[model samples]
Target: MAPAIMLAADAPKLSSANTGFMLICSALVMLMTPGLAFFYGGMVRVKSTLNMLMMSFISLGIVTILWVLYGFSMAFGTDHGSIVGWTSDFVGFGGIGKEDLWPGYTIPVFVFAVFQLMFAIITPALISGALADRVKFSAWSLFLILWVTVVYFPVAHWVWGTGGWAFDLGVIDFAGGTAVHINAGAAALGVILVIGKRVGFKRDPMRPHSLPLVMLGAGLLWFGWFGFNAGSWLGNDDGVGPLMFVNTQIATAAAMLAWLVYEKIRHGAFTTLGAASGAVAGLVAITPSGGAVSPLGAIAVGVIAGVLCAMAVGLKYKFGFDDSLDVVGVHMVGGIAGSLLIGFFASGKGQSDVEGLFYGGGLDQFWKQCAGVFAVLGYSLVASAVLAFLLDKTIGMRVPEDEEVSGIDQAQHAETAYDFSGTGGGLVGSAAPALAAESKKVDA
Candidate 1:
C-alpha cells in the first residue's frame, strides 16, 4: 500500500486498498468470537466445555442476522436526537447503493456496515463468559436477542454513530472502550447477579481442563486484536493506523509482563492463565486509546491494566458475585483505565487535536473520558439487570440443580465434549481376548 493516498478535495471516491483492508479486518474481528469460545471453554470444568464454546459461537449466528436486518440501522443510520439512529434510514440496508461510499471515508458503505457488524457479534459473546455452565441455552439465546436490541445497539449509537451524544461530546473512544468492553463488562456483572453463583462456588476446585486450549484462544485473540484496534481507523493510509497497531503490540506485551510479575509476587508462581488474562487486559485498555497514545503511553496503559486487572479478578470471591471468567475484571476495569487515561496520555500530534493533561492540556479530556465511562457503565448495568431479572422470573435463566451437577453440556445440548468409548477398536478387542485367556489359565 502507498504510504499515503491523498484524495482530491473536490472529487473524493472509494479506494480499493482501503476496502480490502477493512474487509480483512472485519474477518479478523469475526474470528474473535470463536477465539473467545476456546478461551472460555478451556477455563471451565470438563463437563461444561461444550456449553462454554456454544455460548460464544451462538452470537456469530444470531448477531449476524440481526445486524443485516435492523441492528446496523439502529446503530449507524440517520441521527436521532443524539441518542440513536433512525431505523427507517437503513432498515434492511434499504437506501444504500453499491456505488455509495461511507459519508467522508473512501470505503464502500457496505464495507463499513460489515465491519461494524463484527463488533456487534462479539459484544454479546463477551458476556457469555460470566454466565457459563448453568445458564439455559434457550434463555441465553433469548437474552442475546434482547440484550443486543436494548443495550448494544443504542450504546453503539451513542458512542460511534454520527452526531452521537458521546461523539458530539468528544468522549474520544478510538475503538469501543465505552461501547463494547465497558458495556459488556457491566452487563456481565448484572447477569451474574441475576443468575446467582455456580453450584460449586467457593468450595469446588473448578480447575481448567485444558490450558493448551486457553493458550490457543489467547493467541488468536491477540492476533485478531490488531485488526480490531487498527481497523477502527477505517482506513490504512492514515499514520494513526500504524501507530495504533504498534501501540496494541507494545501494550499487550507490557501488560503480559506486568500480570506475570504480579502473579509471581502474589501467587508464588507465574501462570499461563495470568499471561492470557493479562494480554486480554492490555488489549482492552488500548482499544479506545491506541490511536491517540504513543508507544510509551501504550506501555503505561498496558502495565496499569495488567496489574489492576490481575487484582480485580479476585473481586468475585471477595464480593460474593461469580463472574465466571473475569470479564468484569479484565474488560471493564481495563477499559475504564484505558479510556480515563486518555485524558492524561492523549497527544495532540496524534489523530485528534485534543492533548491530554500530561502534555499540559489539564483535566478537560480526563473528565470527558470519565463521563463516557460512567454513562455506558451505568446504562448497561441497569438495562442488563432488568433484562436478566425479567428472564429469570419468566422462562428462567438457569438450569435445574440436577442438570447443573450432572453436566450442562449433556442437559442443554444432549452431547458431551468428549466421548472416550472406543469404536470396538481393533487394538482393544485383540487385547481383550488375550486378557480373557490369561485370566482363564490363572483360574484353572
Candidate 2:
C-alpha cells in the first residue's frame, strides 16, 4: 500500500481533460477569424467583399507562421522589465517538449501556446474592417507583419505574460478586453486616419452587400466567443471557467436586446445590423469582466455596451474619419466600456478578491482597470498610427483611385466576389458605382 501510494504521487503534471478542453477552445477561437471575415465581408460594398474576406483569411496564414516563429516568445516568454518578453526557448517551438506544462496550469505548454496563438491570429484581423475597400492587399499584409510584431506582441506581454506590468498591477482583463478588443479598435482608428476615407466619404451609399452573411458571421462569432472567453480560464478545475461561460451568454443576450430596444426607440425599427453589432458589443464587454462579475452584472455590462456602442457608431460621420465597417465604434468603444465597467461590476466573489464600485470595493479596481485599458489604448493608437504612416510612405497603403472607385475585389485579387460576365458591360455588376459615375472625378 505504501509503495502504491508513493508511485501515484509521481504522476505527470498534464491533465488530459484540461488539455482536450484547451485544444477545443483553440479551434473555436480560430473559427472567429473566418467568422470575422464573413462579418466584415458582408458589411462592405459587393465590390470589396472578396478583398475584405481575403484580408482576414490572410492573417490566419500570416499570424500562424509568425506565432510559431517568434510571436509566442515575445508574448509569453520571460519578461524583460514588464514591457516585453524574451527567451530563446520558445522561438520556433524547438526547445519545448510535450511534457512541459505551463506553470500554474495543468495543461501542456503546447496547448497553452497554441491556444494563445489563436488570439494573436484574430486581433489584427479585427482591424481589417476599418480599412476595407481602400487598402492595397500587399500593404495591409505587410502592416500585419509589423503590427503584430511591434504592437500586439508587446502589449500581450504587458497584459497577460508572467511578470507583466498589467498582470502584476492587478488589471482585471479576464480574456482580452485590453489586449485584443481595445488594441485592435485603437489600431483601426490609427490606420483609417492615415488611409483617409474610401473615395466618397458621405456622398456614397455604402450599404452592406449582404446582411444574411453578416448575421451568419455574427452568429459564428457569438458561438466561438464561448471558447474565447471561457477557455481563458485555462481549465475547468474550478467554477471560474463555467462562471465565465454563463456570464458570456448572459451578457451577449442582454447587449443584443438593449441595442434592439435603443434602435427601435430612436430609429423606429429594430435593425438586423443593430442586433448583430449589439451582440458583438456584449461579447466585447464581457470578454474582460466575465470571470469577475455575476450574471446580473453581465447583463448590466451588456446593456451599457450595447447602448454606448450603438451611439458611438455614428461618430465616424460626426468626426469625418471613415471607418468603413464601424470597427472603432464597435470594438474600441465596446472594449473601453467593458474594461472600464470591470471597476463597477466586479463582484469580488468570482475570480479575484477585488470588489467593484457597486460591490463595495470603491474606485480602486476601477482605477486599475482604467490604467490597463488606457495604457493599451494609448499605446496601440500611437504605435499603430506610426506603423500605418510608415507603410503609407513606403509602398503606398491605399489602392489606386481607379481601382477603388471601380472594384477593389477585382483590381486587387484579380477576381470578383460575384460573376457579372454575362452582363452587357462585362463585370458591370461589380463596377456598378463606376458605371453610374462614368468619368466623374471624386474629390480626393
Candidate 3:
C-alpha cells in the first residue's frame, strides 16, 4: 500500500502517447459548443436568431470561470462527508502535470479536468433552447450560474466523483448518459415549467429560421462526437478507442436516416431540420453506450432513439407542456432509452466483455441499468423542480408579457437581431407602445 501510494504521487510526471490523444480529444469536445450554437440558432424565429446564438455563446465565458473556481473541486475533489469535496488540491490546476492519475492512464490531471469542464459548459447551454424568445438575457444568465451550482455540481459529484454513490453502485456511464444528458434534460423541463411558454406557442408557426445553419451545426456536432465518445477511454492504444469511434459514426448515420424517413412519411417531405435534430438525438443516446456496445448494437440504439424522439416531439402539443424545442423529448427520453437498452445489445465480436441478457449474461445488467436510469431521472426531476421553484419566487423566472411580445432581443438585450423596418421592427427603443400593443392583444 505504501508503494502504491508513492507510485500515485509520481503518476503526474509520466506522459507520452496517451496524453497526446487525450488532449486532442478534449479539443474536439470543446468544439461542440460552437456547433450547438448553430444547431439551436437555426431553430428559433428569424427575429430572435442572434439572441439564440448569444445564449450558447455566453456559456464559454460564464461556465469556464465557474469551473476553475469551484466546479472542478466540487465535481472531482475527494468527497467531503458524502455530499461534496473536502480538499482543493487541484484548484486552478495547481498540482496537475504530465502524469497518470490512475493505473495505466498517462494523461495529466489537467487533461481530465478540462475535458470534463467542456461537458459542464455545454450541458446548461442545452437548456437555453427551452427558454428561448421570452427570457431576460441577464436573468437567464444569472439563473444558469446558480442552477449549475445548485443542481449540476451535486449531480456530477453523485455520479462521477471518486466517492460518488452512483460510481460505487457500478453505474457504467462511459460518457454521460446520466451525468450530462439526462441531468440537463430533466433540468430543461423544470426551468421551462417555471418560466412558462412563448407568447404564441400554440398559435404561431415557430419554424426554424435557417436550414443551412441547422445542417452546419449538425455536421460539427457529429464531427466533435468522435472526441466525446472515444475520449472516454483516456487512451488511444487499445482496440476500445477505435471501436467506439466507428460505432459513433454508424449510430449517427442510422439515426439521421431514421429521422428523415420518419419526416418523409408523416409530413410529406424530408427536412434539413429533421436530419440535424435526429443526428443530435443519436449522439446523445450513444454517448453512454458507445464504449460498451458492439457496432450492431449502436445501429439499433441510433434507430430507436431517432424514431422515439421524433414521436416524442409531438408531446409538447399533445400534453400542452410546451417544451419549446423538444429538449425533453430528444435529450430526456432519448437518454433514458439509450442508457436502459444497453443491457440487451452489448455483445458480439470485439464487443464489451460484460454481455447483455440477449447473450445469456442473465438479467442482472439490465436491472442494474434500469436502476441507474431511475436514480438519475428521480434526482434530476425533484432537485431541478425545487430549484426552479425557489429561483422563481426569489428572483422571477419569466419576463413580463409586454417584454415577451416585443421580443427579448430588444426588451432584454438592448439589441435587435434584425432591423427590418428601422426602429428595429417598429418596437426598438420604445417599450410603452409595445406594451400597449401587447395589452390589446391580451393572450399575445
Candidate 4:
C-alpha cells in the first residue's frame, strides 16, 4: 500500500479537461497528414497521383510503429548530452503507466507522446513533395524509416526535449518552424541535389493535375494547422493556446492575400495554386512565432513569408535544382523567415520575457533564433543527402528512366490513381501516353 501511495505521489496532477483538449488537438494534427496527401496528390500528374498520396500516407503507418517502439524515447526521453535522449522504460512504452503525467503539464505522458507522434509522422512526409514522380516507393519507404530515426528524432530532441541544447539556449520554437519545416525543406533540397532533376526538367509545364483538389487539400491543411500550432502549448495554462489560435488564422489569411498580390503583380493572374501554397507558407511562418508575437506581428510574418516564398519558388528554375513542388522555397524559406522574425516581433508580454528587435530586446533573440534554424537546416541537409546517396548506390532511389517517363504509379504501386477507360476507351491506366502512341500508329 505504501509503495502504491508513493507511486501516486510521484505522478504529476492530471487535468481531465486539458487532457481531453490535447487528445482532440492530437486528432486534429493527425488530420494534417491526410490533408497533406490530398494537397500533394492534387499537385502531381494523374498517373502519379496515387504515388504522391501514398508518400504522405505511408508515414502514418511507418512512423506510428516507430514512435511506439523507440522513436519517442529517442526524442523526449531523458536527455543525454543534449543531442539524444534515453530512458529504458520508454523503450516500448511498457514502463509508462496510464496514470503517469508529463512533468509540469496536466496531460498524461502518453497523450504528449501520441501528440508528438503526429508531428514525427508528418515531417518526413513533407520531404516527399520534392522527390515526387521519381523515387521508387520501396526506397522512399526505407528513407522514411531511416530519416525519422536519425534526422527527425534527434532534431525533435534538440528543439523541444527538456534538456535539449536549443531548448536550454533560449531558442524558442512555439510549434516546429525549425524542427519540422526548415528541417524538411533543407532535407528536400539536399535529396533533390543528390537524386538530380525530374525527366522533363524545363521542357514540360508539369502543371498541377487538379487545382480543385489542391484547393481542397490546402483548405484542410489550414483547418488542421490551428491544432498543430495552438496545441503545441499543451493547454491554456497561460492563455497562449488561445492567442496561438487567433494568430494562426490571422497569419494564414495575411499570407494568402499577400501571395495573391505578389502573383497578380508578377504573373498578371491570380492562381488557385498560389492561394493554397501561400496559406501553407503562412502556417509555417506562424508555427514558430505565433505564441511570441501579436496578431499584428503575425500579419507581418505572414505577409513577408508569403511574398518571400512566392518569389523563392522561382529560384528552382534559376538554380537548376528541381524541387518538384517548391518544398524548399516555401517550407524552408518560410520556416527561416518565421523563426528569424520572432527575434524582431516577440513581445515580452507573451510566451516569455523575450523581446524581439522591434521590442525592447536587441539582437540577442535574433542570434538565438538563427542558431536554432541554421543548426537544424545544416544537419538535416547533410544527413538527408548522405542517406539518399547511400540508398541510390544500394537498392536504388529513382526509378528507371523508361518507367519514370511512363509514370511511377503503375511501376511502383501496380495501380494508377485514376482510370481513363471511360474517356473514349483510353487504354485503362496509361491514357495519355497510350493514346499518343495510338495516334502515331494511325498516322503511320
Candidate 5:
C-alpha cells in the first residue's frame, strides 16, 4: 500500500536496557555544555565570563526545542542523494514512544531522538568561543538557531543519517570527528572571519580568569567523553563498549602526557593549560577511530594528536588567523590525526580488518582515510564560509567598536558577573562601583 505504511514494518523494536543506556549517554553529553562553558569562560577576560557562560547555557534550552521540531527531520529523514534530508519523516516522530522502534536499537525512537538531540545542542555552542565578547547576546541566540538549521542539519545528514555519503563511503567517525568536531570547527572559522578578532587579539594578554575552572571543565569533559565515545556503539554489546571505554582512557591519558612533554620542551614550563588542552586534543583524536582501532593504536593516536596540536596551536601567531581559542588547532588537527591513523592501526593485521603501511597492509586503507579527511575538511570549510556570509549580510556580524572596549557583559547584557562579594559596595551598598557607574550612565 502506501510507502509510509510499508516503512513502518521495517522499524526496529524498543527495549529497557537500550533505553536506559542511551538516556544516560544523553545526560553525559548534556554535561559537556556546562563543561564547555567553564572551559571557555576561563579563557575570556573577566569582564565577559558570565556572558560566555550564558551563551553555552542558552544552547541547552534553545536547541532542545528546535531539535524536537523540524531539526530532527532535516538531519535524520530519508536522505536525498547526499545533499540533504527530505521532510517526509517530518512529524513522523509523533508516533514514536516507549515501545517504538529505532533503526539500530530496541530503544524507543524518542530515545534515539534525544540522543542525537544532545549532539545538536553542543555543536553550536562549540562555535560560540570563536565569537566571544563581540556579538550581541540576542543576535548570538538567533544566529545559533539559524546556524543549526542551515549548517548543522545538512552536515549531520551527510555524515550520520542513513544513506549519508560518508556512511556509504565507509568513513568511520565513531562519535563526531566529522559530524561534531569538523563541522563546528569549520563554523568557528566562518564566524571568526565575519566577526574579526577579539579586541586586542595580539596585544592583549587576556589570560584565563581561573585555572581551577578550566581544570574542572576538563575533568567534566573527560568524564562525559566516556559516554560520548562508548555510547556510539548504541548499546552494551559484549565487547565494543568496554573496548571503546578503554581506548578513550588510554588516548586521553597519552595525549595529556604528550602535551605536557611538548610544553616542557617548547615553552619551558608544563602549564596547567597545556595539560588540559592536551587531554582534549587526545579526546578529539580518539573520537573518530576509537571503534576501529586497538588500544595500542589508541595510544598512538593520542600521542600524535598531542604533539601535533601543540605544534599547531603556535601556527596562529605565524599565520596570524586568530582562532581566538585554538579551535582549529586542537579539534581540527586532532580529528584529522585520529581519523587517518586508524587506517594503519585497524586493518586486521592487529585487531581490525584494515591494516596500515606499518602493518604491511599497504596504502589502500590509508588513502581511503585520507580521502575522508580531505572531503570533510573541504566541504565543511566551503559550506561554513557561505553560511557565515549569509548571516553576516542579513543580521550584521560583530558589535560596534565602542561596545568591544566597554565589555560585552555590561554593554550588551546590562549585567556583570561579580561584585567582589559585595565588598566593593558600602554605605547602604551604594550599588557597587561598576553597577552604580552603569546606572548613572543610563540616567545621564
Candidate 6:
C-alpha cells in the first residue's frame, strides 16, 4: 500500500493549464446536448418538435445526476475483471479530493469526471432521434435511466477505462467510435425493434417543419465537435490534438460534398438535410480514427461513411424500421466504418504506435478493431433490447396511436412547439386587410 501511494504521488503532477482546458472542453461538450435537442426537434414535425427537444434535453438533467451518484465510478473506477469498475472507489465522489489528479493525467479527477459525464449525457440522447413522435415520454425517461445504468456505464468501462478489456487489448478508439456512437446506434436499432413502427412511417408525408432549426442544430454540433474530438487528448498542446482538429474539418467537408454528390445522382436535388446529415456522418466516422489516421485517411473515411450512410438511411424503408432521424444509419454505420477502417489506414507515426495495413501493418490490427466493434455492438443490442422489452411489458413503452397521430407534443408535454394562435390576432384580425387588398387587385 505504501508503494502504491508513492507511485501515485510520483505520477505526473496536475497541471493548471490542462485542467482549465478540460473544463472548457467539458462546457463545449455539455452544449452539444442542447444542440442535439435543436437538431432532433427540427427534424420532427411541428406537432412533435417540443417532444423531440425534451427527449434530448432530459438526458442532460437525468444523466448528470446519475453520473454524480455512481455512473462515473462505475465507468472509470478500479477495474473489476475488465468488464466493469468498482463503484465504491468514487461513488458520490466519496474519497476524491479537490487536488486529486486523474491517474496518469495532469487534470484534476473532478474535471475529468465532469468531462466524462458530458459524454455520458449526450450518448443516450443520440438514441432519442430514432424514437421520435411515438414513445411515451415517461417510458423514454425511464429507459434513459435503465439503459445508461445497464448498457452505457459498462461499455464505457470496456473501452476507455483503465484496465478495460479492449483498452488492454490495444484497441484504438481515440474518442468514442465503438463506445458512444456505435453503442448508441445499436441501442437505437434495438429499441425501435421493440417499439415497432410509427403510425405514419411510410403512409404520411412527414417532412421536417423547420430546416433552419435543423441547420442551426447541425452547426452547433459541428462547432462543439472540435472539443469532442480534440479534447480526447486532455490537452491542446499535443501534436495529435492539432491533427485531430484539422482532420475533423477536412473529413466533415469531404463527407458533406460526398453526400451532396450522391443526392444529386440519386434524387436530382441536393438538399440541405443531406448536407447536414453528411457532416454528422463525417463527424461520427472521424471520432474514433482521428488520432490514428492522417488527413487523407480521414477524407477516405468521411467519403465512405457519407456514401454508405446516405444509402443506409433508405434501408429502414426497405427493412421496415422507423428510425425517424436516421440515427442508426448515420451514427452506427459511420462508427463501424471508422472503427474498421482504422485497420486499413492507421498510421503508426500518429498518436498511436500501431500501424494499419496501408501503413505496412498486417491484418492483426484490423482484426482487433473488428473484435472491439462487434463486442460493443452485440452487447448494446442485447442489453438495450432486453431493457426495452421489460419496460414495454411492465410500464408500457409507446403512446396510443391517437396520441401519436394527433400530436405527441400535446399528449406527452401538454404543449405545442408553436402557438400559431397568437399570430396577428388569430389570423382574421391581421390578415383581413391583406386579403381585402388582394381581392381589390383581382377585381381591378
Per-residue error at 255 for model 4, in Å?
Answer: 0.6
Off by over 4 Å in 4: 1-12, 423-444
Give the local distance difference test score of model 4: 0.93
The digit string of per-residue lDDT tens for model 2 on 1-444 reads 999898768754789999999999999999999999999899999999999999999999999999989999999999999999988999999989988989878899999999999999999999999998899999999999999999999999999999899999999899999999999999999989888998987998999989999999999999999999999999998799999999999999999999999999989999999999999999999999999999999999999999999999999999999998989999999999999998998898899888999989899999999999999999999999999999999899999999999989778876677765664433434566675576466532
* Model 1 bad stretches (over 4 Å): 1-9, 87-89, 423-444
In angstroms, how far off is 414's CA in candidate 4? Answer: 1.3
lDDT of each: 0.91, 0.93, 0.80, 0.93, 0.81, 0.91
**Deviation from native of the Cα of residue 345 in model 1, angstroms:** 0.8
How much is 30 displaced in model 1, in angstroms? 0.7
- lDDT winner: 4
lDDT of 4 by residue, 25-80 (tens): 99999999999999999998887898999999999999999999999999999999
Candidate 3 lDDT by residue in tens digits, 1-444: 999999878754446677778888889988998998888888888767777888888998998998888888888788875566644666766655545364346677777888888888888888887777877677778877887887777778777787887776666677888888888888888777777778888997888878898899889889998999898887866688888899899888888899889989999999888988899889988888887788888999999989999998998898877787788999888888788777877773433477777777777767878877787777777777777777778777777888777666766665666666654453456665787688789966
Looking at model 4, how many pairs of residues clash? 0
Predicted structure 4, TM vs. truth: 0.93
lDDT of 4 at 240: 89
Evaluated at residue 112, the lDDT of candidate 3 is 82
Clash pairs for candidate 3: 12-99
Superior by lDDT: candidate 1 or candidate 4: 4
